[model samples]
Target: MKLGNIEEDSKMSPAFFLQRLPAQRRSALHDVINIRHAYHKLCEICEEVSEFYGFTIFTDMAHNGILVTLVSYFLLVFFIGMIKVDLISCISYGVIIVWFAFQTTVLTSYVTRTIIQIEKTANVINKLIRQCAMNKKVEKELLNFRCELAFQKVKFTAWGVFSLDRSFLASSVYGSVHQRNLIYVKYIFFKILGLAPWKLNLVTKPSKNRTAKTIICKFSYLGLLYNVLLTTSVFLMTSYFCHQHNSVQAQVDSLVTPSTMMNLQYFAVILSSSVFLNYTCRQKDMIGILNEIIKIDKKLQKYAFNSAKNGNIIINLIFLGHLIICSTLICLQYFFLQSFWLAVLRCWPAFLYCWLIVQYTIMLDMMEKRFKFINLNIVKLGEIKVNSEGLEPVSATRISFLRESVLYDVVNIKDNYNKLCDICNDISDFYGLPFLKVMMYHGTSTILILYFMLVAYYESKEFHLLLFIKDVGFVLWMVFQIIILTTFVNKTIDKIAGTTATYLIILIQFRASTPN
Candidate 1:
C-alpha cells in the first residue's frame, strides 16, 4: 500500500495500483482507468489491422510484396482503362476505376474487422458481467466500461461514400447494387445516343439565342460523352478482370457473403443497444446523484431553478443548429437529383452526416442539461437559510433542520462532484476520436465535391440556370453541415468548462459560509 510500491507496481498492474489509492480516488478512477485500458487494447488491434492491410510498411519483403501486388492490381486496371490504344481519354475513367477498386477492398476490410471487434468487445463485457455477478460495484463499473466501448466502436469510413460497417453494408447492399446497375445502364443508353453521360447543361445567365443554345448543348454532350466512355471502360475492366482472377474474386466475395452480412447486422444491433444502455443509465445515474445532493435541505431548490434558467439559451441553440443541418442535408439530397432513388444514392453521405450530427448533439445536450441541473441543485443547497436566534419554536426547528442539511450537503458534494467528473471524462473518451474522424471526412468530401464543381464549370460552354442553382445549393449545404458539426463540439467544450467553473465557485462559497 506504500506509495513507492504502488508507483513501482503501476507499470505492471494498474488495477493493483488503483486498489492502494484512497477510497474516493479509487472509485473515481476505476471506471476511467479500465475504460482507457480497453481503448488501448482497441488501438493495438487497429495497428495490427493497419499492418495487415498494407497501410504500414512491413520489414518483410514478402508481406510488402503482397501489399504492393494488391494495390497494383487495381491501379493497373485503372491505368489500362485510361489508355485508349493511342492517347489518354478525356473522360478520366481511371479515377472512377481506382475509386471503386480502392473502396471495395478498404470497405470490405473495415466491415469485417469492425464486426469482429464489436463481437469481441461484447463477449468481453458478457464475461465480465458474469464474473462480477455477486459484486454490484464491479458489475456497475463493467457496465459503464461496456458503454464506453460501444460509443467508440471501431468503424472505417473513408469519406462519406466508402464507409461500410457491418450494419451499413448489410442494409444498403441490395439498394446499392440496384443503383449501381441503374447508373451503368443510364451511361450505356446515353452512349448509344451519342450523348455525354457526365455532361449537364449549366447557364451563367439567361440567353435566348438559338446559336448559343446549340453550342452549349454540343459542348455538354461532348464533355459527357468523353467521361461516359472512360468510366464505362473502367467498370468493364474491373468486372472482366475480376472474373479472370480468383484472388480478386475471393477478396471481394468475403465481404459480400450472406454470413458476413448477417455479422454486420448483429454488430449494429449490439453496439446500438450498448450505446442506448450507457446513455440511459448515465442520465438516471446523474439524476439520482442530484437528488442525493439536493436532499440535505429545501433551500437549495431556488438556486437550482436559476441555474437551469441560465442554460435555457444554450439548449435552444444546440437544438436549432441540429434542425438547420438536418433540413439542409434533406434539401441537398432531394433538390438536385430529381429521381428519388438517385437522390438517395448520391446524397446518402449527406443523410449519414445529418444523422451523426443529430446523434452527437442529442447526447451532448443531455450531458449539458444535466450539468446545469446539478448546478441548480448546488445553488439551492447554498441558499438554505439558518434560523435566526430568538425565533419561535417552529422557526427554531426549521432552522435546525436547515443547518443539519448544510453539513450533509457539504460532506456529499465532493463525492458527487467526483462522479460528475467521471461522467464527463468517460463521455469525451468515448466520442472524441469518432467525432474527429467525422469532421475530417466531411471536410475532405466537401473539398472533393468543390473540385468537381470547378471542373464542371471550366468544361461547360455555358451554364444552365437550373444546373447552376443546384451546384450552389449543394455547396451551401456542405458548408452548413460543417458549421453544425464544429459547433456541436465547441458547445460541448463550453459546457464542460462552464460546469468546471461552477464547481469551483460552489466549493469556495460553501467553505466560506462554514464556521471553520
Candidate 2:
C-alpha cells in the first residue's frame, strides 16, 4: 500500500508498537539497528584490504579480474568468428570463452544482488514507518537513517576511476582494449631501460627479504654495468672520430661537424651516467620517493575523485615518435662519417638521454597534477552556492560539515603539499647536476648549430637539404623539451601558490566570522 494511505490508517509507529511487544521481538529490532554499525565495520575492512593490495596505485582486483576475463573472451570470440583456426583450436577457444562468460555472469550477478539487497533496506524502513503512527522522535530517527543511506553509499570502484556494476563491463572492456597497446608499448620501453619506477612495489608486506629480492630482481645491478659500458663506448667512438678529424679543414668538410657531435656525445654520457647513479647509488632514496608519492595519492583520494590524468599514453607516444624521427636523422648523419655498427652504437647515448628526459617529464607532470588537485580542493572550501537571491552564504549545517570533514582535509592537504615539495626537492637533488649539464650542452649546441647552419647556407655553393633539416630538427626538439619542462614547473608553482592563497582566504573568513 502507499505510504500516505498507511499513515492515515496507522495508530502508532511500528517501532513504538515494538516497544509494547515481547522482549524477544524487541531483541530482533536491536539486530536491525546494528546494521549501520556492521556496514561501517565492513567499510573499514574493505579499506584495509585496499591498502594492503596497493589498489590505490593500480586497478583493484575486481576490475583487473573482470578486465582480463573480458579481454580473453573477446579474443576467443574473434578467433572463432574468423574461422581461421583448426577444429581443436576452435574447440579450445570455445571452451575458454564459455568459462570466461560464466565467470563474468557470476561476478556481475552477485555484485548486483548485493547492491539491490542494500537498497532494499530503505523499502523496509518505509514499510515500518507506514505500519503505525510515528512520534516526532521516531520520525526524526527514520529521516536521519534515510539521509545516512542516501549520503553514504557503498560503491565498488576501480581506483575510483569507474564503478564496478553491470554497465561497467562494457566500458571497462572498451577502455582496457583501447589503451592496452600503448600501455604495453611504454611498459616494455621503460622495462628494457630499467628506468620504470613502478617496477618497485609501493605497498610492502612485513617481509624485508622478499622486498629486497624484488627490488634487486626488478632493478638489477646489471643496469649500472650496461650504462657504464654504453657511456664508455660512446666516449671511445667520439674520441676516435675526433682523432680522425684532427684538422679544422677536415672537420669543416665533414657532413656532421665534430664539435656538434661531441656535444651530443657528452650530453648522452652525462644522462646515462646519471641514470646509472640514480638506479644504483640512490636506489633507496628513489624507492622512498615513490613510496611517499603513493602515500600522498592515498590521502588525496579522500579529496579527489580520480587519480591524476598525466596522459601517460599520449606523452609516451609523442616521445616515441620523436625518438624514431631523431634516430632516423642521427643514423643518416652518422652513415656518412662512420661504419654502420659504430653509427648505431653512437645513437645509444642519445636514445638513453631522451628516455631519461621523458621519464623526468612524466614525474613532473604527476607532481603538477597533485598540486592542482590540492589547489582545487582549497578553492572548493571557499565556494558558496548562490540562488536567485543576491547571495546565499553557506548554511550553518554546511559550515559545520566542512569543519568536521574538510577542516581535517585542509590539514592533510597542507601536509601533502609539504611532502610534495620535499619530493620535488629530492627529485631536484637527484637530477640537478645532470640537468645542469643538459642545459649547458643544449645552450652551447644551439648556438653552434645556428652559426654552422648560417655559415653552411651562406658560404656553401649548394644548399645541403639533409644537413639543414637535421639542424633545424635538433634545435626545435631541444626547444620543445625545454618548453614542456618549464611549463610543468611553472604550473606546479602556480598551483602551490594558489593553494596557499585560498587556504589563507578561508582561514581569514573563518576567523572573521567567529565570536570571542
Give per-model TM-scores.
Answer: 0.36, 0.55
Residue-wise lDDT of candidate 2 within 330-428, one digit each (tens)?
A: 566564544555555555554555566676776787787788888777767555211211155666777566567656776787799999999999887
The candidate that wins on lDDT is 2
Give candidate 2's total backbone clashes.
4
Model 1, span 1-516: residue lDDT tens: 122233344456567546644453355446545665867687668645654654222233245346556555655444434323323432344454556557555666757876686658656766655542223454566677677666665544433333345433332223434333433443344333222223323234444753211112212334444544544443344334333432321111332464443343233333333332333334334334333333322233423332223333443454456555545444544444434443343343344444545545545654555555656556666555322322335465776777787667655655555555666666566555445545555565566556556766676645556555655666676576567656766766676577567767767866675565
Q: Relative to the true structure, how large is the alpha-carbon lDDT of every model? A: 0.48, 0.61
Regions of model 1 farther than 4 Å from truth? 1-338, 385-400, 410-416, 456-460, 503-516
**Candidate 2, which ten residues in sequence have the lowest lDDT sum?**
211-220
